[model samples]
Structure formats: structure tokens, C-alpha cells
Target: MKRLMLDGPGALRWEDAPEPTLDAPAQALVRPVALATCDLDPAVLQGRFPLAGPYPFGHEGVAEVVAVGEEVRTVRPGDKVVVPFQISCGACGPCLRGNTGNCAAHPLMSSFGLGPLGGLDWGGLWADLTRIPHADAMLVKLPDGIDPITVASASDNIPDAYRAVAPQLAAYPGAEVLVLGGPAAPSIGLYAAGLAVALGASRAVYLDTDPERLSIAAKLGAEPIEGAPAERVGRFPIVVEAAGGSKALIAAVRATANDGWCTSVSVQAKDTALPMLEMYSRCCTFHTGRAHARPSIPHVLDLVATGRFDPSPVTTRTVPLADSIDALLEGPVKLVATN
Candidate 1:
């Protein structure tokens, strides 16, 4: 099989690799039917973060269960499933509390496509085949009649977006939401905005320099704000920073309402100064952590199945596995590579 490997910063290559098989009772062997890049991949490739090279290069994909171990009964061979970015064992304490991202039974770090995790740098789904651990806990079967391309984002982006707004929904019902960033065509932001609306948000504002992305946000019922940091303006009770930039981060904090909440999905390597005095005075609550993808995947998928959310519009292009690298390097929105 062929897989995308990161040789160094701004460097991506497709190389031959061994096929993956079930390595444990809770594992399953899956053949990717479709895969897409996360919003953070390009930034990591550009060395904007502390990511090291020669690692697996993708973390989002939809696949078919080709085989499963004895302990895996939730899904069977031929079932289509969404694979989350984080690998976790279902029985752990963290997992029981719906925190699958920090599952304790797995390796201390088991993230896909990154070496920071202490486990086998589990390569991403930008390949013909991949291994899924704790199969019953990690894979979510796609709903009947839903396009595989549409649900690809559910593997990571959609769930991550949902997590960004989950903590704020109860406190600020119908509160305004401001999303910062325009990656994978403002995918993370757009998904979150849609979720917020579904959850009864009164308004969802999206800020991005890209006109195309802003247009998409508008179509999804969000008010689009365009321009640079100086030109962009808005104040919201819940702000989500997905832009992955220092200026965007600062703007999100500055624009948040008093006693508001700001959720950050962007990963920045550089140190950023915060308005501590301002935040203190305003009584703002800021939360930053990895999205517990596995646990959130099911609910997001159900929403998609019920027609409450549609991620298909975010896909700008779809290519074959052979063109995965090119798809990763250039795209304004979601790009899927199919086998």
C-alpha cells in the first residue's frame, strides 16, 4: 500500500508501506474509502507548530471494516465507519467520562500522523489500509444513504467543531458565536456555526480573510466578517479560535463579551501574550484542549443522519489515493482522497 509521509517541513511524499492488520483482540483492519486533511495539517507542514517530520501525514478518514478481531462486535466486515484522530481504549477512566482523547489504557500519546505521541507514530488514513484500535469504541458506522465524502469530516473536524461549542451551549443558550480562521475553507468554523444554530444559537458570526469561505458561512446562515485584524470586528459570548494565528488568537480574546467563553482549536507554536487584566476584569473563561473525537463522533453522525448538518459542502475537491499529497498541499476547503 502507499501512504503519505512527511520528510520535513513543507515536504510530503507518497511511499510504499506495509499493510496493517489486527494486532490485538480489540483491533480491526480497515480499508479507507475516503480521507481528508485536518485544518492543522498544512500549518504543521509549514512548520508553524512544533511538529517534527517523517511522520504519518493525515488524521481524518472514512473506511470499511475489512476484518475485525473477536472482541469487536459493534461493526462487521463491509460496514462503513468513521475513524477518529485519537486512538483510545474504551474501558479507561477518561473514556468512561466521555474524554476519549485522553484515554489512559492506550499509550500516553497515540495521536495519528504526529510523533509527539509516545506510541507507534500510527500513520494517517491517507493510505489504502490502516489499523483501528479498540474497534468498537473508536469506529462510528456511517448512516445509511449518507455520502461517504459528506461524513469524512466527522472523523475529526466535525466532532472537534462540536466540542468547541458543547461547553458553552448550556450557559449561553442562543448566545452569539464568533469563529476565527479559514482553513480547509473555514471548515472547523463552519461546522461549529452550524452546530451552534442547531443548538439554538441566536447568531453565529464567522471572520475570515477569504471571501469564498465567508460566502460559504453565509450560505450556512452565519454572518460573515471579512478583512484583517484591524478591519475585522465583532463581540460574542462564545468565541472559537480556529484561524491558527497569533493575530487571530488576540482578536478572539479581545472581541469576546464579558463573562464569555473562548474555545481554541488552532495550535500555535509561538508564545502568545494574553490580556490577563482584561480577561480578569471581564470574568472570561478560556478553555483549550484536544477534542475528544471518538466520543463526539457518534452524536455528530446522528445529527448528519437526521439532516440537521451537512458537511458535503465543505469538500472542495476529491481525488484518488495516488494524488493525496497534491490534495493536501492545495485546497481552499475540504479535500478528500479516495481509494
Candidate 2:
């Protein structure tokens, strides 16, 4: 089997590797049919992230169940499914509480494809075949009518964006949403804004410095603001910070209405300062962490299957697996590679 291996920053190659086999009755083997570039991929490839590679490089995709172990009953050979980025056992205390990202049964941050952060032993979705433990718990069968490419990011980005807005909107009921977008997780920001609109937010306003991001946001039905405002954009009950810098995070926090909630999906490698006094005065709730992707997969799939949400517009290009290396090097907003 051959898989995409990240030799170093901006260096990748197709390398032959041993095929993965199911070692446990609860495990399964899958062949990735559609792989998407995670927003973090470019950073990892470009050396912007603090990671040393020479490991399998992808974590988002839809796959075909090539084989299943005896204990796997939810799916069988030939079933198409969304393989979550994280590796988690569904019976742990944290998983039972809906924190699959912090499942007590696995090492902290045990996942696929981020090298050390995500266990290297688990490999990546860019491979020909990968093993998935806790098959029924980790794999979400793609709904019959949904296109696999449209929800390729359902494994991570879509669910990350979904968490940034859906629950907040549900709690606030028809309130407006504010999305701060830029380099980090750009597609996630667009997805968040789009979900807000599709889920019935009174209005979804997206702020970003990049014209391309603003354009995509507008196409997703959100009001696009060209430049970052000097002060608060507007008081909103739900604010999402998908932009990477401290400036954007500050803006997002300050822009929240009294008692509002602001969820940040950005990755900041260093410890940064925050406006504690303002948050104290505003009484805002701030949340920032890794997305517990598994539990949200089914809901996101339902959104796509029911025609309530469409994530296809965010995809910048579609290329076959052979062309994935070039597509990944180009680093578009969202690139989906089909096998």
C-alpha cells in the first residue's frame, strides 16, 4: 500500500507502507475514498506549526469499509462512512459525557494524522487502508442520499464549525451570529457562518481581512465585512473566532453581548494575553478547545442529508488521489481528493 508521507515542511512523497489489519474484534479496516485537506494541513506542510513530520499527513475524509472484524455490527464491507479524525473508545467516562476528544480510554489527544499529537501508530486518512478501533463508535455511516465529497470535512472541520454555532443558536433562538475569519481554519469559519444562517440565525455577519474569505462568506449567506473593526463589530449573542491571531480573538470576545457566548476554534501555539477585565464586566462565556468530532458527526450528516445544510460551496477544488500532492501543495481553502 502507498500513502502520502510528510518528509518535512513542504516536502511530501508517496511511500509504500504495510497495509493495516484489524487486530481486535471491535476494529475495522477502511480504504479512504475521499480525503480533504484540513485547515491545519498547510501549516504543518509549511512548517508554521510546531510539528516534525515524515509521517502520514491527512485526517479528514469519507471511506469505504473494506473489511470488518467479528464484533463490528453497525457496518460491514462496502458501506461508506465518515471516519472521525480522533481515535476514541466510546465507553469511557469522558466519552459517555460527550467529550470524545478526551476519552479516558486512550492517551490524551490520541488521533490520526497529526504525527505525534495524534498517534503515529494510527497512521493517516491519506493512506490506502487504515485500521479503526471501536468500529461502531468511531465510524458514522454516511446517510444514503448524501454525497460523500460534500461532507468530506464531516470528520473534523464541519463538526468543529458546527459546535461553534449550532448549540449557541439553539440556546439563543433567532439571535444574530458573528464570525471572525482569517488564516487559521478559514473553511471552518465559513462553515460556522453558513450553519448559523441555515439553522435560522436572524443574521450571520462574517468579518475578515481577506477578500476571498469574505466572498465565500457572502456566498454562504452571511453578511461579509471587509476589514477588522477597530472596536466591537456589533453586540451578538453568539460569536465565533476562527481567525488565528490574538487580535481577532480579542475582537471576538469584546464583540460579544452581555452574557453572550464566544467559541474559538483557532489554534494558538503560544500562550497569549486576553482582556480579562472586559470579559468580567460583560459576563461573557469563553470556550476554546479541541473539537470532540465523533459525537457531532451524526448530527452534521443529518444536516446535510435533510437539505438543511450544504457544505459544498466551501470546497475550492476536487482532485483524484494521484493529484492530491499537487493540490495539497497549492493549499486552497478546501481541497477534496477522491480515490
Candidate 3:
């Protein structure tokens, strides 16, 4: 078997590796059908993000179950499923509470694809085959008629976007959403904007300086603002900070309406500035963390199945898995590599 390995920034190569087997009763072996890059992958590949390398290279994907252990009942051979990037045991305390990203059964960052941060050699989806533990808990079987390419990002970014607004929109029905997008990984911000509209936001306004992203957001049914956000953007009840910059983060935090929720999906490697006084005065809630992807994937899939949320528009292009290395290094807004 062969797997894509990231030697370092801008340094990706294919290397031979032993095929993964179903080593546990709760495990399953899958053949990736469609694979997508996580929001930070492009940055990591270009050396824009600081994560070190020498790890298997991919995390988001939908796959076909080729084999399953005796204990895996939820899915069987030939079933198509979405694989969450994070590793977790369903029986663990954190997983029971829906915090699968922080599952206690493994190290804090146990997951796929990510190098040192991923915490284990669980392998990457870019390979011809991969092993999935806690199969019943981690795999979300794709609904009938759903294309694997459309929901390939359900493994991570889509749900990461879904989490930014779903709960807040539910809390404040018909409220507006504001997304501050930037050059750094625009897909999450775009997804959030689109999902806000699909999930019943009265208005989903996307602010970004990039014309391409603004146009995509508009096509996704959001009102696009083609520039940076001001100190506040009309007090949106649901605000998402997907633009990976301190200034954008501050603007996103300040834009939260009184009692509103602002979620930052950007990976802030260092302590950054925020409008503490403004946030305090507004009494807003600020949330920033790695998404607990498993719990949110079902809802995202349901949305895709019902024709409510379409992730295809966000996908800049789809390439054969054989060409994934070059396509990934080139880094479009969202790229899907199929087997």
C-alpha cells in the first residue's frame, strides 16, 4: 500500500506502508472514495501554518467500508460512510457528553492526518485504505442518493461550519449572522454563511476582501460584503470568525449582539487581541475550540440529503486521487480528490 506523507512545508511525497487491518473488535477498514482537505491543510502545506510535518496527509473523506470487525454493527462491507477526523471511544465520558474531540480514552489530540498534533499514527485518508476504530460511533453512513463528493467535507469543515451557527440560530430564531472571511481558509467561513441561510437565519452576511470568496458566498445565498469588517457589523446574533487574523477575530467578537454567540473556527497559534470591553458590555458568548466533528456530522448529512445544504459549490475543483498531491499543494478554496 502507499500513503501520502508530508515531509515538511511544501514537501509532500508518496511512500509505501503496511495496509491497515481491523485490529479491534470495534474497528473497520475503509477504502476512501472521496477525500477533501481540512481548512488548515493548505496553510500547513504552504508553510503558512506552523504545524510541523513528517505525518500522513489528509483527514476529511467519505469511504466505502471494505471490512468490519464483529462488533461493528452500524455499518458493513459496501456501505458508504463519512469518517470523522478525530479518534474517540464511544463509551468514554467526554464522548458521551458530545465532546468527542477531547475523548478521554486517548491522548488529547488523537486524530488522523495531523502530524504531531494528531497524537498517533492512525494514518491519513489519502491512502488507498485506512482503519477506523469505534466504527459504529465514528462512521456516519451516507444517506441514499447522496454523492460522496458533495459531503466529503462532512468529516470536518462542514460540521466545523455547522457548529458555528446551528445552536446560536436555534437559540435566536430568525436572527442574522455575520462571517468575517479572509485569505486563510475561506471554505469554513463560506460554509458557515451558507449554513446560516439553510438553518433559518433571516440574513447571512459575509464580509471579505477577496472577490472570489465574496462571489461564492453570494452564490451560497449570503449577502456579500467585499471588504474587511468594521469594529461592529450591525450586531449579528450569530458571528463566525473564520478569517485567521487577530483583527478579524476582534471584529467578529465585537460584532456579537447582546446575548449572542460568536464562534471562532480560526486556529490562533498565539494569544491574540480581543475587544474585551466591548464583549463585556454586550454580554456576548465567545467560543473557540477544535470542533467535536462526530456529533455534528449527522445533522450536516441530513441537511445535504434533504437538499437544504449543498457543499458542492464550495468545492473549487475535484481531481483524481492520483493527482491529489499537486492539486492539494496548489490549494483552491476547497478541493476534492476522488478515488
lDDT of 1 by residue, 253-323 (tens): 88889999988877666788988898999888887767888878888888788987777767778888786
The whole-model C-alpha lDDT of candidate 2 against the native structure comes to: 0.90
lDDT of 3 by residue, 146-219 (tens): 99999999999998999999999888989999999876658999999999999999999999888889989999
Candidate 3 backbone collisions, by pair = none
lDDT of each: 0.78, 0.90, 0.90
TM-score of each: 0.92, 0.98, 0.98
For model 3, what is the error of residue 213's alpha carbon versus the real structure, in angstroms, after optimal superposition?
Answer: 0.7
The per-prediction CA RMSD against the true structure, in angstroms, equals: 2.1, 1.0, 1.1
List ranges where model 3 is wrong by over 4 Å: none
Off by over 4 Å in 2: 229-231
Give model 2's clash tally. 0
Q: Would you list the clashing residue pairs of candidate 1?
A: 181-243
How many pairs of residues collide in model 1?
1
Q: What ranking of all candidate models by lDDT puts the best one first?
A: 2, 3, 1
Number of clashing pairs per prediction, in order: 1, 0, 0
